[model samples]
Target: MLRYGDYTLSDDLITKITAVARHDDLVPSFVICQLCHETALGQHPNSISAREDNNWSGMTWGYDDLDPKTRKSGVQVTPGRKRPAVEGGYYIHYATVEDFLKDYGYLLRNGGFYKTSGAKTLWDHARGLFRLGGAQYDYAGDGSNSEKVFNSYYTSMKTIHDALNADGSLDRIDKGESSNMAGLQSLFSIARQYLNEQMYGSGHRRIVDTYNGQNPLPVGYKLKIDDDWCAAFVTAMSILSGNYALTGGECGVERFVRDVFQKKGIWLGKVRPQAGDIIIFDWDANYWADHIGYVESVSGDTVYTIEGNSGSPSAVRRQSYTWNMWQIKGYDRPKWDYASPAPLSVGGKSIDAIAQEVLTGARSYRIKKNTSSLFE
Candidate 1:
């Protein structure tokens, strides 16, 4: 009998993939399975190019090319371009796995294919690949008639998932050694705080307070200063958690983003959005960004955000407001150099309790330190 973790390559790959998925608040097993099917566990490096260019299923290039009328000269042909090129057969290439992962995460985050009723979870994402009764699989290369490819991918993913017990259950081979419960909880809690700050005011601390109260500012509030809510939230969480800072700031949002981006193997400079990533936006139309938000969720054509000072009188608030409007001007997700556990106060009271007392419905308690500076 083959044990679930028998395949070393698949197991290790799945572990890495799961870490990525979990960090992105996605289902680790589902993403691993899908990628396994798509990349054959990196056996087909060309598949990364395929995904980049044609969005093909783990394969490079498409079967057909564009006609000459549609073709334009001066175009770059990178990689995975089929021979006897058609009019618009352009080659694409990904320089590294980091590049591929960023693009892949962007696709999954913004891909319309995953928004349909049939594709809510990572499991749905996998099954949706075999839509139309399995007669046709989306993204699968043409002339590849083997259903075994998908089966192998699915089986391999299941094997990995069973080994890791990635569903937050106890089926794992190592008894959940790989699960980062504390890390995940911290991330989630920080994300919630980020949302609250964006919609209401950073001054507001408690989630319950923001949920119950009216807008923090007056009805006709207009913000004078623009603070990068996303960056500020990240910094606040990092400081509270006692993480190391590579750069100086009031807290350390930029440093945190930089560290996390580097640590997670994600490219730091980019315009694409990833789920749970702190997205910075330049509201003043200047090249230098002045605003930021956490990607609460991504649905086709709609991105749910948790930002600070989005409302009038741009200030920190407790509740998070959802905004579908606004163009994505810029983004940054930095890697962390080191993550130290947040120190426990001698009193031993939970952070949540402190935040509640500071933030909850006690509008008087929530104080606005400085309007122009994110550090405040």
Candidate 2:
């Protein structure tokens, strides 16, 4: 199966989509999501827009009269019936895939895609599509109760967007292109460092000290050696791994889910998870989440997690569970771009980041001959 973000697409559609989007100065991830929503990534069962006419996204013909001068208005053709979401007037037909992609990009930019609300994030662009997309998107086309339509559209798009972020599919698609594997590697390394440590006993000081010393946690908060550390452990590791920007900082499971994860748009509620995601467990089967941990790996239906406060005395240990494990509440999945060039609160700029800046001429370090020190 060919994959692009959370959903698998029909034959090599991602390459063409990304190429046209990048070339046309459109957001690739949003374009991918729009395509997936419109035509199921060029493979909608009852729709032959992509297969027959090279139309990926469900771009209907603008009006009865075709204007060849308009960059977006391609040849109009009567096409097969599609799902209600995309059912509309005459569909645009293209002679080639390249023609369709290029026209799609031109249509979005030159069309009525106004009011992006800064367009900083995927959700922002999605909102722009509905709110300001009267001439093209048509979400508010019918007119009455447009706010209700927007909310419903946003909720559905959020699910698609969140899944794309969680699986590292949007890793390279996001702005600045952070490395997801680098962040995962750092978490694994940190977990390995505290694997054999004891909890709540006389020997628990080391892990506690290491966490406190290493992480620049926000003021007014610090953990005791024997305190409930499951949440602390995950947050601290996130901070230390240079993912503070993505994961944020939180000490309580419920607070983290509601405040940090959901607030930042990385919380996946009751969705199938992948490795390197944070898992919450409620042993009592209550909606209140009781414990937290990060997934170590996944094999078929089983999920392996390395957790703190798991045993009788709550020491760090690896445990395995089924995919539908009863104790699981939800997940706190980080976006694939964990080590972005954006500011990381836990630590200053990393060597890799520094090197990138220098290469791009955004930064330069010079040694002071008088003081024997350097500044960038």
The numbered model that scores best in lDDT is: 2
What's the TM-score of every candidate structure? 0.44, 0.47
* Model 2 residue 205 distance off true place after TM-score fit, in angstroms: 2.9
Model 2 residue 246 CA deviation (Å) reads 2.1
How do the residues 1-376 of candidate 2 rate in per-residue lDDT, one tens digit apiece?
2364444853234545654564445666777776766666777775676667777775666666654334434523434334366565656667677677766676566343543423566666666666444334444447566567776767766777677667666645433233446767655665655564567543244344433543344343667865787886675455444455656655567787886777765665654556777898887997888789888887767889888777875677888888667888877667643344223222376544543343344543332211212233
The local distance difference test score of each candidate is 0.40, 0.60
Task: Give the residue spans of candidate 2 off by over 4 A.
Answer: 1-179, 201-203, 210-219, 341-376
lDDT of 1 by residue, 70-186 (tens): 112223233554434454444444444544554455444433233212344444555445442232344343426445554554465566555544454323311213223343244
- Backbone steric clashes in candidate 1, count: 24
